[model samples]
Target: MSQELIQAVMVLTKQKGFAPEVIFESLEAALLQAYRKEPHSNPDAYVELNRETGAYKVMAKKQVVETVEFPETEISLLDARKIDKRYEIGDIVEADVTPANFGRSAAHTAKQMLIQRLKEAERSVVYEEYYSREGDIITGVITRVEGKNVYINLGKTEAILPPTEQIATETYHEGDRIKCYIVEVKKTTKGPQIMISRTHPGLLKRLFELEVPEIFEGVVELKSVAREPGMRSKIAVYSRDENIDPVGAC
Candidate 1:
């Protein structure tokens, strides 16, 4: 077991918000990668670590045989018995070979691999959180404008407001703050693609639901909505109880 390696793994796990086991697994893979680069290397090297003590070992599997043709697979029966006494002719033995010969390059590569994997994991988490927020209102600041599309920064992600979704009378510049309704959500190969709109009728309904307590509390229900972008919008409402005035509620 490498105490320094275990400490480093713990630090990295905390920094990346990843579990300690994941970090240890990445370390084991890095050790195997380094071991595979040399001559007389075992192709099938397995490693395991004790979660309590952080003790780890690297072992190679070899078949027990009277005569050895391939040294990598077959080993003399006497050497196999030294590691494990229960070893028979058809049995396999595990030989420990944990050493500190992993080069600086291999260590650096392992660090990069860990960082990249953690980033992908974090992105997946953020995507799952935002995916449930589809067809809802999100506030953002206008970051930049490209041709006709505006990019709005929504904390973790930037949403694209296309020309078709923008209100005609609303002119936006950089640093301007606005709230838009999420019209659609798509998962692209890169990440989540959130299509936001200011002209959508759903935005009006959502706004009324936010402004009125009765609509949100189930006292009044929003039936239908229609909008004319920046001009005007009409929303139909109905109440479950006849005593509740739906129009007055909004």
Candidate 2:
């Protein structure tokens, strides 16, 4: 079971591009929760997992005191000294409380919890990745059209191009590859919702940046854009160098 857990974590880390530490932390937390629900579990116990070996131990933290008022949270100095002779009254002793038989049901519960945590982490990673691209242009293939929404497959995730964001005269079909400007990115319970647009002025601005070397290199600046969806659009431009003609560059 321990070897299997380690192998699963490694597979997920490689396939999902997630850091190993993130997976380990999530798994440890999940296992800790599962351990807490066991029959003889201690409230003051925590899980210590070996990253390399995947072995885990549930340890209870007890403070050494002259008088053990709380048996669960405190240990008498004499008892503590028995475990470790150097232990003092004020010292903290971590006692292994791992179950002799951590049943199959408990392991199953831990697996489910780990899966849930990994999904949430994946959603957060996807949200942050697309959120940073909000105002940028991306190319994707139209996957499907549902009512007034067109779904585009952007390799890693899907994006929504709503009717309001589409060009008035344009028609969308599945398998058609197109470019869109990312307007907004939202994190929802379902997942990351990427709102893209075909008619946004930023789309033309981005096109200019992609096609024109002068604009992309900062020698030519695109001042503003006025567009009428599928109709013609106009852009104002200026050049930093007097020798460079921004209009000719465009």
- True-structure RMSD for candidate 1: 3.6
Q: Give the whole-model CA lDDT for all candidates, comma-separated.
A: 0.79, 0.90
Best candidate per lDDT, number?
2
Tens digit per residue, CA lDDT, model 1, 106-175: 5666567666666666667668767898889999999999999999999888999999999999999999
The C-alpha TM-scores of every prediction are: 0.76, 0.91
Per the 3 Å backbone cut-off, how many clashing residue pairs does candidate 2 have?
A: 0
TM-score of 2: 0.91
The residue-by-residue lDDT of candidate 2 on 1-250, one tens digit each, is 7898889988998999999999999988888899888775778788888999888888898899999877767889999988999999889999877776774656888889989999999999999998999999999999999998999999889988988899989999999999999999998998999999999999999999989999999999999999998889999999999999999999
**Each candidate's root-mean-square deviation in Å?**
3.6, 2.0
Q: Which segments of model 2 are wrong by more than 4 Å?
A: 38-44, 65-69, 76-79, 103-105
Which consecutive 10 residues in model 1 have the weakest lDDT in total? Answer: 97-106
